[model samples]
Target chain A: MSTKELCIHLTELHAKSLLNDNDTFLFDCDGVLWNFPHIFTGAVELLNYLTEQGKRLFFVTNNSTTTQDDYAKRFNDIGYKAKPEQIICTAWLTAQHLKSINFKGKCYVLGMQSMKDELEREGFQICGGIGPDPVPSDSNAVTVDTLELEKDVDCVISAFDLHISYIKILKAATYLNRPNVLFIATNDDASHPQNDEIVKPGNYNAK
Target chain B: MSTKELCIHLTELHAKSLLNDNDTFLFDCDGVLWNFPHIFTGAVELLNYLTEQGKRLFFVTNNSTTTQDDYAKRFNDIGYKAKPEQIICTAWLTAQHLKSINFKGKCYVLGMQSMKDELEREGFQICGGIGPDPVPSDSNAVTVDTLELEKDVDCVISAFDLHISYIKILKAATYLNRPNVLFIATNDDASHPQNDEIVKPGNYNAK
Candidate 1:
């Protein structure tokens, strides 16, 4: 048959067959489940129906700005049952990846507070991501020669940061310039949808 | 002749021949003429000799941290006769490039005050390079939704900035995301020598 002929449309018969064939469901939160402040049509009903059918469900997203706990809270707020373990977000995955590699040191982050919280929950020391580290008022005051870098920063994590700065880049580059220092980016998304007209820059743009 | 056999040492005979063959010479400042705070042994003598012989010379460097005037001042301070016109640095080159293209708009700078001075001298309005634009102390106070961006930015220039921040990156990225906006980088140097042990991360690392 041709490719177009092989394509199947979603009907009641097809839906019943699909449910019977699949024991689990995976949903992407940003666009599939909801777009924040508004849930998609039948998204909640579908999740409830899936739960009633005893089908396992997992929420997957590349949002590193929020932690797994944050995702769980968001899902519950929207009337969806989501456990911390059931939400697979970039922030949680980043921490998990570090743990899997047996990394034991401080992480200099260029991301949000939630990313730091996720790493901290994984028993890692974090720096650089919480608040602004603006350039000195007198630009000449802080030269690379005078800037003090942390001695124990073993990894540099790049994620979605609203407050990325030159000082942070200098520190991250200086640390990564050393041998065996790890450079981790939570995601490489170029931009994220904010609304119909504006999109926020992602981790790739920070580079 | 093989490459090794063709290579001749810089004896007086070869030096005389080289001066006779070439009427103009170009020198790199960092490692060649001086290492900063210390001039090489015969560097000054050679420049004086070249000037006596009426050889035209140029000082070229990828350093965007200082203006051409700064370079001329450095050379004169080290007992070398250098004019601003004889010095070619990245900061000067960047401004020249913008002018050459007939660019007539504001520049968002991720560089030093000297770089800003160069652009201003070339008749361009500038922003974002002077001082500390740290993230707010309360990180939660600012989100992508609430972040304010400048509307007049037409070009994003990335140079050697010590005070690069998340806010700057956001602005640059947002500006560049527009269709007609330009992105310019002063240099692509991976690293610059500090002394013997430590190397400062250069413009390339900022990316």
Candidate 2:
């Protein structure tokens, strides 16, 4: 599908309801806020309107590769005043959600570094990944700490990765596919605008 | 199996393989290096040996959070001179591996900020997820991102999330089940050692 179709679908979201001051409005960053190659035509206007209305604008995206400051700067560079407190990207949301719900203190994340760090903040202990060594390859499954299944977990979050491979898939799917484990994502855009080209990597494998 | 059994199996890896001077020895930081509560029996020795032998000791781990520098400091605090350069964290590895494979530089990762930042360093364009939101009351189909099904994606990687509901699984599984899509994991440990307690929130969910 073209970006137009995706954008149209995304725009339809706004028609469903006008966000209230008390109710939070969640907006994905790329396709929704800033369309591929071009910022959303009405983005600044909408932000201005929201600010005037005193409504909470939450930029809850799934792209974990950036921090709120990054998004804020990008938005600012693109002519919008993106606030750190308002731009609740996936990493931010993931961290807040986990802490609010009290996710387990120790975690075995399978995501970008930010997501991992976010989890660690909620008192979760981080266990790193296995390296590319053991010759025969899949002779053995990588060993991880048995913390969640052994007890209870808050969730499992995944971020965007441009260079994901079969091994990453097998490892991530292995865990994300579990019934007891919680699964979370940053945003759900099929493609991201990169260097004037629409790049593909996130939606298919991790979504 | 039990923790001891798992440990025995990991130790058995030494016998199952040959030691190489060039083959880097990568180890996870949180659980494998130490018991989380006490100092690892030989962390200092191991680090010193790794540096002295000039063995490329790459710590390829799945913990998708903390940054390489943060990890280095943690390792250093524990008496190991771990540098961000010496670490092959999942976040960094994802980007490094993606560049090595000539990926599209677009990503759909299910991880944290560090994971995303690390991948972006390799010039990756991060994508968010898109789909219908969860039914609020349901736990099975929590959609994290709002991406479409037909978007072209190069790969998918997962890290740690403790809050994924059942609904989220349905969405990700639908995408990941496709053919030719790459999957990768930073680490596969089921959990991590938080404090005196053996906490949960590891990779068992996605296993």
Candidate 3:
């Protein structure tokens, strides 16, 4: 039988049992919970129903550009009263992973302000991720001396960024050349989805 | 059948398949990895064997008095090369939970310096957890006016502390009485273990 036909034949009791058996519900924020730029219809009602049933709700997503606070504010503005702790984004995960590993060195990053803010809040020393953009004239040549890099950097973190640059990539690559330097990416999405079109993501080539 | 008699013998192939089925292995640090001050016999050899087999390792524990960095240092000192990110203590989890929830208000904490450091590193505004001890003369009686509190606190975090005080408890309790306040505990461990002895742990009274 076709998959669609099988789904239509599922018993209501079995569906109810599936929901009743689980005390916690973990929803993927993007796509499943809501499409970007707007929340899906009945999503709010479904969340309310789960809460009324005393099921713990968690929003898990890979969108690393927004901090938990930013996500919480957006949720509230979009009519979902989500607490910050209930939202687990990749940005927070990256920070947690770094902290858990006891990384104590400076980091060269390729991402946006949200990723930077999350890492910084976790007491990570971050550079080359977000801030004033490097001018095209800043680089004299394609080749950069290894000595030119700020010393003692031991980590290179790559995340989604609209402002990713060759300079940022060069810095990240340079730091990653050291065997001791750790390299991390929030997710491995080579293309970003926007308004129903896919385009090469900025972090795609960031080492 | 007797409990021991009920055990079924497994073939070497089955044991090998079980080991080969997974790429990661998680070990509890305190009892399994190390018995307090010393590493257990064969623990190092077992870890070496796992690493040789290309298995990923993680150390999970509930000791919240130390940060990941501290734990890593101890691991290194004990001849096990461990990354800080491999350690997941309750202190780090507490901080991660608070940050994920986007808790922006001040926190009244009842924890040790490590917990305070971890939370403070996450940019939490914390007080009443670790600092100068409350003077006995400062309190005329057990009762304290609500106005005496540093207002606007919206979180009360409880973790293990070596210097827990009545003043800290009162302050944490007062902040917790607010309807909007968030209360969090690292774990439900009522007593702390040291050198094979369990003693009354800090955070025993904070609800």
- Find the candidate with the highest DockQ and give its number: 1
- lDDT by residue (B1-207, candidate 1, tens digit) is 896798668998988899999999998888677767678899998998999999999989988888889988888888887999999998899999999999999888878888889999999889564545656766742365665677787888888877766566667777777878888988778776565434556774343
True contacts kept of 2: 0.00
What is model 1's native contact fraction? 0.44
What tier of docking accuracy does candidate 1 attain?
Answer: acceptable
Supply the TM-score of chain A against the true chain A for every candidate structure. 0.89, 0.59, 0.84
Which ranges of candidate 2 are over 4 A from the true structure?
A: A1-207, B1-26, B45-57, B129-152, B177-180, B193-199, B204-207
| Span of 10 residues, lowest total lDDT, candidate 3 chain A | A138-147
lDDT string, candidate 3, B1-207, tens digits: 896798667699986986889899888886667755668897888777887888898888887778888888988887778888998988888889988988888888776677887888899888666643442432322322232566688888777654443355556765776678898887775444334211223345323
lDDT by residue for model 1 over A1-207, one digit each (tens)? 896798678999999999999998888887667777768899998998998999999988988889889988988887887889998999899999999999998899988889888988989998565556666667653455676678777899888777766566667777887888898887777776555434555675343
For each candidate, what TM-score against the reference?
0.83, 0.40, 0.45
lDDT of each: 0.79, 0.57, 0.70
Interface RMSD of each: 3.3, 15.7, 27.0
Name the top TM-score candidate.
Answer: 1
- DockQ for every model, please: 0.37, 0.02, 0.01
Candidate 1 residue runs with Cα over 4 Å from true position: A1-14, A35-41, A127-130, A141-145, A196-199, A204-207, B1-9, B127-130, B140-146, B196-199, B204-207
- Kindly list the per-residue Cα lDDT of model 2 for residues A29-93, writing each as its tens digit: 76666754467678878877776776667787767766677778887887767788877767667
